[model samples]
Target: MKLLALDTSSEGCSAALWLDGQITERFELAPRGHTRLLMPMVRELLAERGLKPSDLDALAFARGPGSFTGVRIATGVIQGFAWGLDLPVVPVSSLAAVALSAMEQHQLADGSGVAVAFDARMSEVYWATFACRDGLPAMQGNERVCHPENVSLPDPDTTTDGWFGAGQGWKFVDGMPEAIATRIRSIDTSLVPRASQVARLAIPAFHAGQAVPAEQAQPVYVRDEVTWKKLPGRE
Candidate 1:
């Protein structure tokens, strides 16, 4: 399957192509450059592979809980591509993407848990926990946006030694409950979600018939329900 994935959900802007089973990606830590950089990265990836948008079977993106504008940028771009190519789209969770990326980087075993948190300004975080399942992240609970002091593990009672914390949200660990902090084996505050992991997480979903129409694909913002600002052409 030929799938194209993009993620602009954090300070990072990335585009990736999943060709058959091999994945190729271009990523940069360009905080506000996503609007100007994302499409070019997609173009470059497709050009290097001698493929066109029509050649792709599906599109994927990190759909939420990061920078509000960043999520909208990805959603708009993917929706436009999906409409033009008449392809299915897989909306992967930004938190899950972070978790899977952390798992790969740490070489964690299956069942090992990752608590992902994106530092949402105003002293809150976009948080969620996931367990590595067959090399993919399986969410342990609903994604939420909450104060660092309120952050938690879905199953704190379970063995916690295998759990690790990831993302900028970890910067606020000192404010979280001692119980939750103690359970985390360690923390990686430098990690950001990438399109490579988004593509990795979307492949199986695409194959399993989880891909959806462009109109049905939407960005997920875990906080401020009434304040969402969508990209142009979207209601």
Candidate 2:
């Protein structure tokens, strides 16, 4: 399968091309540079592989629960690519991508529990737990946005390695429930979702008929409702 993936769901901007079984990627920690960096990364990845947008069989992306602007950027880019190329798209969770990335980087065993959290602004976190299965992260529960103290943890008895934490939200470890804090064997504060992992997670889903039309693919924002106030005298 020749799939292209991109992620701009955090401070990082990345793009990947998964050809057959090998993957190549371009990534950078660019806080507000995604709009500029993302397309070039995609173009370069395809160019390096001696391919073009038409050569891709499908597209995938890290879809949400990170910087709101970042999530929108990735979603827009992937949707545009899918529409123009007439390819299917798979939206992988931003948290799931981080969890899978951590699992691979740490070489966690099957059944190892991974709890991923993104420091969602406004004193809350975007969080979820996953269990490593066959080198992939299978979410254990619904992803949510909540105060650090209310984030969920994996069931201790079910995982082989207690629990490991990943993402900037782990920076709030002191605020998390003690029950969760005590179970985490380690945490990676530097970790962010990447396109390579997004592609890896998407491969199985793509084959399983999870890929959708560009118009059908939508971003998943755990905390969906947003409130805004009109600017003074600017009705």
Candidate 3:
């Protein structure tokens, strides 16, 4: 099966092509240039592999819970491509991508849980928890947008030692609960959702027939009111 994926839901913009089993990807930390970079990256990846939009089974993308404009850029692009090619669309969770990255980096075993939090800016975070089962990160609860202090495990009774924290939210959030903080084996602030991870996660969904029409593919901005203004001297 061949699949194409893209993500611009964070500081980075990335595109990936999954052909049979081999994967090819391109990623860039273009906080303000996703619009210019994403399509070119996609075209380049496809050209390198001699694949066309119609040659792929589906197009996948990180749907949301990151930068508002970034998320929209990905959603809009994927929707346009899918709509034009009449292909199915797979929407992967940005947080789950982060969790998957952590799992791959730490080489965690099955049954391990990961808490992924992305700095949502405006003193808030987009957070979620996932359980590593069969080498895939399965979301434990609904993804949420709220203050970091409000972040907690879906099941408090789950073994804390099995939990890990990841993403920039940990860096911005102050005074995290000791119980949660101590249990996290490590926290990676540098990780951002990537298109490669989105493609990997989409494999199962694509086979499971979880894809939707391009028009139905929408961004998942957990926050209701996404209004924010940039502060002076802050990028």
The better candidate by lDDT, 1 or 3, is 1
Tens digits of per-residue lDDT for model 3, 1-235: 9999999999999999999988899999989989999889988998998877788889999998898899888888887788779999999999999999998998977878898989887778888999888899989879998887777876656544478888989895465666678667777888999999999999999899899988778888898766433222323
Model 1, residue 72: displacement in angstroms?
0.7
Residues 117-155 of candidate 1 have per-residue lDDT tens digits of 999998999999887777788888799999999988876
> Which pairs clash inside model 2?
none
Poorest lDDT segment (10 consecutive residues) of candidate 2: 226-235
Error of 1 at 181 (Å): 1.1
Tell me model 3's lDDT, rounded to 2 decimals: 0.86
Local lDDT at 195 for model 3: 94
- What is the Cα-based lDDT of residue 55 in candidate 2? 86
Per-model CA lDDT versus the true structure: 0.89, 0.88, 0.86
All predictions: root-mean-square deviation over Cα? 1.6, 4.5, 5.5
Task: State in Å the error of residue 144, model 2.
Answer: 0.3
TM-score against truth, every candidate: 0.95, 0.94, 0.92
Quote model 2's TM-score: 0.94
Candidate order, lDDT descending? 1, 2, 3
lDDT score, residue 203, model 1? 90
**Clash tally, candidates in order:** 0, 0, 0
